[model samples]
Target: MVVANDEGGVKPSHGGPAVADAAPQVDHGMLALTLGALGVVYGDIGTSPIYAFREALVASSGGNVAEREDILGVLSLIIWALTIIVTIKYILFVLRADNKGEGGTLSLMALARGAFAHRPRWILLLGMLGASLFYGDAVITPAISVLSAVEGLNVVTPTFEPYVVPLTLVILAAVFAVQRFGTASVASVFGPVTALWFLSIGASGVVHIVDDPEILLAINPVYIVYFLANSPEVAFVTIGAIFLAVTGAEALYADLGHFGRRPIVLAWLAIVFPCLLLNYVGQGAFVLSHGGIVGHPFFEMNEGWALLPMVALATAATVIASQAVISGAFSLTRQAVQLNLLPRLEILHTSETQSGQIYMPRVNMLLGIVVFMLVIGFQESTNLAAAYGISVTGNMLMTTLLLAVVMLKIWKWPLVAVVALTSMFAVIDIGFFVSNIVKVLDGGWASLAIAFTMALIISTWMRGSRYLFEKTRKNEMPLGFLTEQLAKKKPQLVPGTAVFLTGDPLSAPTALLHSLKHYKVLHEQNVILSVVTAQQPKVPDQERARIEKLNDLFMRVTVTFGYMEQPNIPRALAICRKQGWKFDIMTTSFFLSRRSLKASPTSGMPLWQDKLFIALAKSASDATEYFQIPTGRVVEIGTQVAI
Candidate 1:
């Protein structure tokens, strides 16, 4: 049975400690967390007003008169989409399926996958596709968000038109460059600036919304239903754009662990939802008064004097949102590495106190390259819209499918409740997915291409890892046999503890056996250490380490860390002291086996895939640094593997 970390973590099904879900008392701590969630979690949806409405209206009118019905219908669709997709489906439903209080596509997958010891491997395929889609979204978010924000300069004068793309490229380069400093340093300012952004947009919308109060009629569901009934073709095309309003809905769940469910939910209900509603309404009002301001309805809503200031705030807000997605990608990569779906990557912990704040140089550099290319290539937010819609919608659909498994199999909800809820979600999600599918020829193919490439890499890595595990195990001797032979050999007893790091706890580590063969010496105490990544996001300190005596001189030590956590073998070993095992930091030596992977024609995988696997392993970060082991006390043994 699984148990979750207690207090700030989730409780496992095996009656482990649970993070409290009780409402916090009125305090600055609670308010600060809520405000922080506002800045990070809602930035994408918050900035959607800059482009979503204009794009949808353009699709609806098709350059004809922007009739009142068309404006109201699009507005009505945007309103209800946000309500059901973001508010009900995500915040209320998917967030509850979190793994140890961590919610994301991979976390949800781990939680569901952990519930069954045996199941079809195809289930993992869905999770991989979701993660791949997230990468596509990551590349698009910064490009579209910054491009749309900078496009506001066009309203001030025609002079800024030619320079928009160049300016956006400069801003993106600087933003990616600062990722190494970590979010903790900048998050304090992000919250307040975002708060101001919401206030300004709400007030801006209020100005137009009050003048044309008739636009408020769009909030009624009748307009949406009637519009679709009367003009099915128009409604179908328009909704492909309307889906933009809730594009960042998954962020609410993906970022749940950062601020907790209470803070994220509070931020949405109290701040984000209201402002987004107002801005959308204001856009509708502007469209009604001025027909077909399709290319620039959002900017046109602002008064002339306020245009420049609003543009500046918008650029800052979009930068903040883009940073949020990049950081999420780093976290996702680390989790994938720990789960063995991907090869190990170099992970740098940026914040001393916050484990969640990290920087991945490889991921950062790759994202920077892709984002810059997109900004220059796409050149306009309208063109990038098709690609953005496909990525986000695909991710949303994947979440729904994964949540169906969680609801029926993991959470054990009633069959009727499960069927009804998933069916409703499926209809809406499938509609959005289908609408975006038509745009594949119009740059929507970009997201699909990224997803397919990543899925292939991930699957190949998993398969390669399994093959190596089996190949190595075929030569490994059991611990009992090793101990028996060692007693008979009577090798020289060394002075201190020797810890052998092994991938498999059941078999003898290659390093330990190699040491005996080469030097014919054994330590006074031999500790077989295996660092296991748990399926949960975090394993509590109390349950982190387990110790068992294999014999008088040999002991089996397994240290468990959550996929979200950084592994430190030294720190984990210290926990064994309470269990009657004395661990000394000064004299202990860590033995690590480094494999030299060779691509073979007869390898289980195709020759090209074998080469790809070798390249990934060669670039993988060193195990000693990854496990936080001291360099001075580490020994490396090399092995050749043809897989």
Candidate 2:
């Protein structure tokens, strides 16, 4: 079940308040489904304990300090960081920012667009920036999540140390290899596996807590306060590390359409939160007793009989994390296409049962290459950690800002409460954001590079679209104006009927320009056929076909349909035949303007970016086969255009 946000450009009516076939069921079966969803979707955030604690400890030391205080301070930071960002901010606050009960970057963007299309342009920029940052996070997530999981192998066995990189690569390869197959059937196991994984983490922590109950004192906010107040400089760096704990929290919002709000929220509150708290507590206890083992404290928490199960659970959790991001990339691409940031692609729904299980080959191949490169480039999970947290933090900050606008303008929440709550989040988000800025030169550039590239593409597409629309609107003739002239200029020449298919519904299409330029004669009877693709999934066949007469010569026609649907122009002709529409197929030439977009300065994009967009357009372009236009009767007129 995947419910699109019922806000945004071309909002599709999906029945009434609750859409049919949206949001996967909430039941015992879903409990199992939530595991897999949690496993893959929640993997990045869930497995942060593997390295967050270690990095915070290192940052706290600043290369010189007592290992005990460093361990305690770092552990306290991770625990409280999770409590504030995940439990309070995301779980308690941000989750409430749903767009017609749908969540995610796309959902949020849709909500903003619907409410603020006529508002200041800065609001749209914020929405796009958040979307761009999400794409950046998508690229880095798999790299860090799998790397962290494989790093655990080194902690358990010395022989496994040297093979961590290769093993992580292998695991990633296997995860991506199965993406085309879809996860509906196999997803049943995700909930149980993740459930056991979190439970095991909690149980392990309880054992350590039993041994050293005094470590529980770190849970108080005062310890976090003390660490921040006493070590302001070093604590800034800890902001970078603490962000790792909530890396996958965005997935909770992004994939909210999959499991619905209730199941996901319940799963997070009931199962995921408690286990995560326990694991952090156990790590704190382990750090308190044996602060000497500073390199990988998470691995040190387990010993003897427990180490092997811990290893197994961590690996399973890592798989879940990787899968979540992969699925997220697909959904994001889908949204991109719908919103026109991306060109059309072959979007294949993997499951007849679950519409959310989608497969995009171009996206999958690209992301797989990038993830594999990150694995080999970083060579270790710990190294990749530098690049991971910054993008997630940036995205979180973007979300907080966008939600403020939503609360005040859309939901009409009181300005004071929205400002106060958003300000608190802004302070925390900015602190983490500033901390991650220091990591820009230290492997953080990868995520930044990705963000920059995506932003460039999105911005270019948006600007180019505006330019194209403005240019067309200014130059092209409106249907009513053209029809009025046609009635007076060529009353004697009107004998046969001619239908011209147009790209734009508002103005006379480029196809008509090419047709009039090539052929000097005008037909007595003229029809302007414009197709309007609704954002909805289905349009009734009858309602999809509409015909209106323009003056006496021009027939203004429109076929309202969906991108997912197959157009039946021949059947449409059959219906028109009954109305005595003179059926002369041979002379009725269907014109289509094929613009040859150039990668030059005139395209309103950099040369490289123009080339990238052109290449993406070519790769994702729709084939002529699906449009139902006649093979021989259609003529494509080529025009070299800069856009």
Candidate 3:
């Protein structure tokens, strides 16, 4: 039997047991977290200098050699993009919308949902769109990051050009292959290695900036305006490429729970931002000095003696960038499953101490296959770059819309202030979205296709699950009335406790009804147990389980877990033991209803959708394994249902 836990109405009351406090500020380990943030949170954006500047300049010049103005203009666009989008909008504003120290699309959705007395459907749809877009980003990041880095070999020697794709595939395969072994052993060096990369790239930029001091003029925002006014058509295309520089900016907000706001902000300002700026300016300076020829400027800027070493370092940095995105995919999928957006996939913990270290075989395999196809199809970083930015731009627009609700309702900001802020962000977001939209025929459709597929799956699962719940609830007897009738007429009482798992605690479980019909007997003790997923990230131990004694013969228990947590039925029931329920696993038999669903023409959805839902239901992981319940103690009651 596979059942998704209810994700609503699990919030503890103010008078109830205290919830866990927000993660405390680790002042003592601030340096460690700052370094860690640079490695993980900044890896994606940090690696962008390798291709972002070159692409923008090339786009601005329209395949011809760039003029002095084009070089300065492209650099200016990249600079302000980082400033307004990453620095001002995300790090300054969106990070403040965190839901109890957790920041992500869904976390912000939960916060916005709670701000009002009643939840709004538009807010939920916005969150789903944002999350679905992230899956598109997840698929593209590894492909572009690694390909761009490996393409550096072409600069080292034309002899390596023929081998670039083969070499890239091998490296990408190894990256996904290592996911099962976990990142703990190698994570310690992520900080140091990435730190060195920043220093090297920064120093390289310093050398060229010294040679051509005039390139510093790009730091002014005026050049961006001048660039746009000079040629609107070319500038629009350049803006699309410039958006690449800020593609990973969302990671800064998504990883807020892992490293506190202070460390991430500090890391960007002190290290990541400055280094990226220098490298980009250096690339510009090199191009300008070489008469506006932009041929892999990032690699060509370095001296011949340093070229091979730089390529090696670039490859390692790209791998780290890919690792961060892959891990984020795993984390996001877990949140989706707990919230019932996706079916439960088998999750294996890689680290005993760190609950966040998880491996999902299905997600990993699927990502790997798609990534390989992308590499083979695109065959060049330049082509893959054409497909990037659409998803990130769409996601950014959704975040802006959702953040407006949080600002006006939760923060109690003046509506005027909220509108102005959202309008400013919306303008930038829409511009980027349109710019990328024009690239749909130039490979951007791949991302849109992936995102559309994911959104359809999420919507279908939600609708089908709701229809099943309503249908099941309509036929089942009320728990209150059923227990009353059973108390009045005594039956042969068994010795062990029989716990029936159900989504709707008010309605009697199907397993319980079938058990009584077949055996014509009742257990000495009965537990109506329901597992609930809270809106928050983690529920405290004191508020984990809520118990009520309906009568002497039956007791009701609702065990709550946060969306970020795994549900372990046995461990949760242990909490009931301490609350004087005398719960014993050895003397208990869990009753679960295993439904075999058949598709009907007259169902809530279309014929094909009904079949899809039935397939999804069958593919779901076993309830006994998913809930961490022992196999020997579980009793499955089979039932047939049409949906």
Candidate 4:
């Protein structure tokens, strides 16, 4: 989809010119991006097999009857579930929804908002809210993925079983602790490890398949029908379990900008999807053969030495999955800041070359604390799993609704085709949504809490923007009118360069206004440098920076990079120096205004919430130094405004 920046002059850079077109070269190998995307993208979906089949068996009562029919039925349902849900729907279809080669709720939202910016107000609000819920999903992902992985030990050792909560806590603590170092340090191992992990799952399934060859019949549609026909209630609850397998399917799209959509789709279709199915089949086979072991049959599948390796492998896989979610949270935060929904926090790029692999310390630390508390509160992965599916399902529901709009309103597809296609996906999503509702009282509230928090943030940003628009004088000082005034007043003032750094380029720059009001001078060479952070994993140096001349004298140059990237303004200034640009850093001072927000009764929002949001903004946002501005020649301007 074509995505336009809110700032009118800047063009969308899907496969076009990017802002950082002049930066130094850094080559993060295709393998590194692939593995990093794999590590981050596959977390929740990777660990789904741990509970998906087991929960389904428990719901079906097929666990107590280990007959050939039961095995066939369970295997069929699982195989078809993987095929229809993960493979066909998400990997094959929905991954195509890209906003200038970027995918995710935010990218999709940006695309939608930009397209319908001039349309009705409801469309904008709904799209923004949907994107905001993704933040909540990011928080809940790691907590549940690691928790479920640690729970596997219960089947191996009874003593170890009770320590699942503490162990998950420790694992999460370690996961969050390592974020400051960035994934570049461990990028080499993720690919081979996750590849081996999938192989092991396939191997485990092969062993079970050898015992009962007839279990292969479970791949047929008959078993799914039989299970559903027998007990609709059981099938309904199993929807929650089945949805787990496809929980992180959207990550295939969300992380598409990092690895590109092709590689991710290839990885999911080839290595990830097949192995997940094999494991589910294996689990189903074990359940069929030993029906009465419903309570914990996953661990009961093997005996002696085999049990230990399986347990160890599952733990490692779980940790890997959790690591992915943590990294995703960092990416989401960067996206939020770029879209202006959240404050700019310090973002550190671990690798100089690979822009996609980033490390944000604040997000890491906050997620660490939350995941640790979650592990202790839930005490077991299964319990945590109850909270896991809700956020993803909610996101999918939003996607389903929005895709309908995209097809009908945006794409202008035939109404019949749109309804037919969207209705099918909606039904599948609603099944998962209803199933997750059963978990609402069983630790499912955590994701909801996080979603509400993010919703508040997004809502506040929108409200604040509206307030600023309403209160500001429209004709008080126009840039075009002021430029005409400057041209007539001082014809000789147009010789040197004046660079103004701004938060939003389309909006009137406070720095520019201050200069016009105080100095009464305008440079012949004016540079409006806008720095935009991309949400993807890495944007190439060629894609990071850009320069455009606005009628010779007024130039608007923007520097765009990933959040995981470093800001080198001095080095950039040096590049400008090579171009014969003249500016004395000491004499040509930098300007930063401190916005003092006051809560007025005028804004149609809850006063308490507005005050809380303002406080949160003040406390949570990083200082100006975080954006890498020079301190010596900088001038601070504080302005008060009522909200």
Candidate 5:
């Protein structure tokens, strides 16, 4: 996993560190993490019963409630979709593609890119695209989940209809507002509450299943084939809506790192899957018996007194779902920033003990605004449903493709086996993807638009960075050259140490060169420091830093960090003392280089992209603060670069 940086002595860990130690904090017993999974991983899909069935029914049959075949067909589609897509693809396969036991679009992409040894351009594009789609999914999941849950109020009383949108907005607003305060306290109970919610809905559906024990025939694939054959028009539209049943399925894989693979799989198979099947079949039975009950089939399944309680519990479950997605967005933003896909913003760690618990104010604020506007724009859960699933499907499609590369190239699987396994998943994914695409004009485009905009920005930043690196490398002076020049000139030797940050350790950092040139002095001790973020989730403490002494006065130190860990220069510097390198907080002065970027048509990128990159760089998180170096002891040297 360790790849040496010849220039700055930076060593990148491609394979990541030992995972046994990577997840210690989260390595709770299976039962505990399962409870955690039930609370977080399954929240999105768990809340789907709130509107998925009713929406599909309305989309398929409309007022033709007497059509038993349509109901059974929709049921079959839902069942198979959950089995094929959620169970087989994500839970069984994609979950296995963890990056040092972490899963997500970016994580998968990093794994795939690393497997190639050399970064292939297409993998980066796919990763960026998938990551972008997730942001869109993040915004939509909260809006739709909350709106659908609050819409339950309309069933309690027709008088509550007008207030549904406003209530949803207020609830969602409250959800986003509390993010800054952290969810450590509230997150614990989410599992028990969600588990209860699943059981309640399952029981409600089971009670109604007695109305039509014949609905059990839906477990037969023949019914699905027969229904699709008899009613093609209804089946097509129904398939699109049926996708809603597994809307939050991606959360299982996206959150694999939090609860690990086994607990999430256990939670789904033991609790989530069965509950979903019972409730879905129960909804089907209820629809057939009541001739499609009015005002949300899910809420209608509950008898008189149960309606209010059901609504309240449903609201709570949806809130949990929204919370998970919002937190996911925050996590995704941090990943993007660290990977240099996005500009670095302020990152606030919310939990004292859990390294994963982080909050980004800019991401939260932006997500809140978009989700609020989406709620107001869509107006109803049913309407918002049209916008859901596109991004999820897109992300899945990309993940499937990336998984193929991992299986064939990374895992050394036979090409035939890789193609066969990936193709099976691809067929289902492409179906769902196309189904969601039909909804583009109906609101799906909203997510696509957001994704496209993000892809534009991510690609721009990445491309601009590649050009910047190439340009910087082209003009670099060799490390030996700088050292020899210092020795020959015999510059005034200062008392304290100077740590200069550079991306390439072999070259002289512009800041170091500038400092030496201007002051005609060199520190008693000098460090060519390069900070690296590995492709893996968590790098062990033992492998955090690598120090190489090139000569008596100079040392090249490459500090390695896993993507999941934070970067702190002072703390990392302290690690070197154990190995005979004296690191004094008071005596060390950090030097940073700031590039004054100028856009040129003939430079690294188009003028517009160059300008955007410059703006992002200018607004990035402060080097002193980001590195956790003392502000008073840090110095920044500027160098102009044409890009």
Candidate 6:
């Protein structure tokens, strides 16, 4: 889970206490939070008007001049997509399914897993798939958003056309480049700037809306029925483009932990929803007045003076949208690492006070490269658009499936109610997914490929980790056996304390056994330490450590951290001090085993996958750095392992 810190940093999830359902006492803090929601939570959906309406109209009309009915039909679809998908499904229902005040794909998966008596394999698979698809969305969002925004230059003048892709690449590069500096300062302005964006778009929308008041009638659901019935095939194709309107709807739920449900709901209803509705409707109005000509209606609707400013504002808004998505990927990556779905990567906390403000250089570099390739390959926003909706739709479908389990098992909702709610969402999700599926040859394959590759990596890492743990356990002595023998044949005793970090506490760590074999001595104070990741987002201090005394010669210490937290061994060991364990860093030496893994054909996974897992293992971050242990007080033992 990615948590947003109280400093208003743009992390994936919020680490602050969950906001109450009751209206917060109106204050500058609450106001600031609401504004922040506008920027980070709603940024992606807020900017959809730039291409959603135009693309739907173009797809419906088959690239020729659009008919009046086609314009109204596409407008009605876009409006209702937002209403049903974003408003009712996400804002009303999905936001309510948060996990302990936290919300995101993995958070929901963790919640759903706890609902069962035993952890189900399918639930884990679903979570992995959802997270993988999110990475796909992460890459595509920046590419499509920036490209579409820069394409607005063509509306300024055809002379600016050649520079659109190059300029977009520069802007995107800058966005990714600055991620190393962190988003704390940049996040401060995200809300205000995004709020201005909403106001500007809303104002432009109202101007054209007044010119053709008849466009208001598109709000009726009857138009959608008529439009679909009249041209079923066109409607099918248009639904994929119409899905662009709600592509970021998942963010509403994903960011539920960040800004809270009330702020997100309020931001959407008061600002984002209204602004998007007006702009989409106004684009329809503008198209109707021009005899159903729909060439860049979002840009054309703004006449001479307003067009340039709108383009500039639109570009800024898209960059913000891209930023939010990239940050989300970082957060999700951390969650995967904690959950043991992926290999450990270097995680750098950007803020001292805010644990949520993190930067993964490897993740940032990978995203930037993929996004650049997308821009170079697609060359136009319309082409990139063809690749966008599939990942988002697939992710939404996975969410719905997981949510049904939550509703039935966790919330204890009636079977009928859970089925009814999920079926409605599943139908909508399936429609959008199937529509996008038809465009597989038209660039949709890119998102699928990315998702598939990520899923494979996650699955391989998980399987490999499990295999290595079990195989290593088979070769280790039980802690009870080791301590009993030590008590009978006491070796030369060292004066200071020694901590052996291992995944399993029941067995003696490899480091401990190697120490006895090489030096023929044991420390006076020996601790068998295991770091455990809890299912919850943040474990309380009271429950952070569990101490078990095995005998005078051995003790077991377990430190628990929430998946959202960074493991600081010293800080956690300090908690042990309260439990009568004298954990002085100066006198304590940490022991760790460094594995040299080699692939064997007899291992469970395929040969290629075994190699991949070994490669991933090699790339994993150093244990001392990851666990925040002091380097000077750590000793490493090497071992050979086959998997």
* C-alpha local distance difference test of each model: 0.85, 0.71, 0.86, 0.66, 0.83, 0.87
Give the per-residue lDDT of model 6 (tens digit) for 331-415: 8998888888887789999988777789999999999999999999999989988899999999999999999999999889999
lDDT of 4 by residue, 1-643 (tens): 1111221111222355776767855555654666655666775677777766666665556344444554466567667767877777777666776766777766666555555545444654565666656666666677776676677677667788767777777777787788788787886677777777777777777777665555667778888788777768867776676676677777777777777776787677677877877777777666656543565555567667887887777777777777776677777666666655665567778887776678877777777777777767776666777777787888887777766776776677899998998888888878888888787888778877877777877677656654544454342355555555555565446444566665445444566777767777777677666666554424566565567654555666666655334455545554554455554665555555566678888767788966965675575443445555577656666667676
lDDT of 5 by residue, 463-486 (tens): 776677778878989998878766
Alpha-carbon deviation at 153 in model 5, angstroms? 0.8
Name the candidate that leads on lDDT: 6
Residue 73 alpha-carbon offset, candidate 5, angstroms: 0.4
Candidate 2 Cα deviation (angstroms), residue 359: 1.3
Q: Compared with the true structure, what per-residue lDDT tens digits does model 3 show for residues 386-478?
A: 888899999999999999999998899999999999999999999999999999999999899889989998787777887777777789999
Q: Which stretches of candidate 5 lie over 4 Å from their true place?
A: 1-28, 62-66, 293-295
In model 4, the runs with Cα more than 4 Å from the true position are 1-38, 62-74, 114-127, 404-413, 473-476, 480-498, 501-509, 512-587, 620-623
The residue-level lDDT of candidate 5 at 64 comes to 41
Given candidate 2, what's the lDDT at residue 542?
A: 66
Each prediction's total of clashing residue pairs, residues at least 3 apart in sequence or on different chains, is 2, 7, 0, 14, 5, 5
TM-score to true structure, per model: 0.94, 0.84, 0.96, 0.84, 0.94, 0.96
Question: Taking the tens digit of each residue's C-alpha lDDT, what string does model 1 give over 568-618?
Answer: 889988988989989998899888887788887766899999988787777
**In model 6, how many backbone clashes occur?**
5
Looking at model 5, the pairs that clash are: 7-505, 7-506, 8-504, 8-505, 8-506
Pairs with backbone N, CA or C atoms under 3 Å apart (clashes), candidate 3: none
* Predicted candidate 1, C-alpha RMSD: 4.9
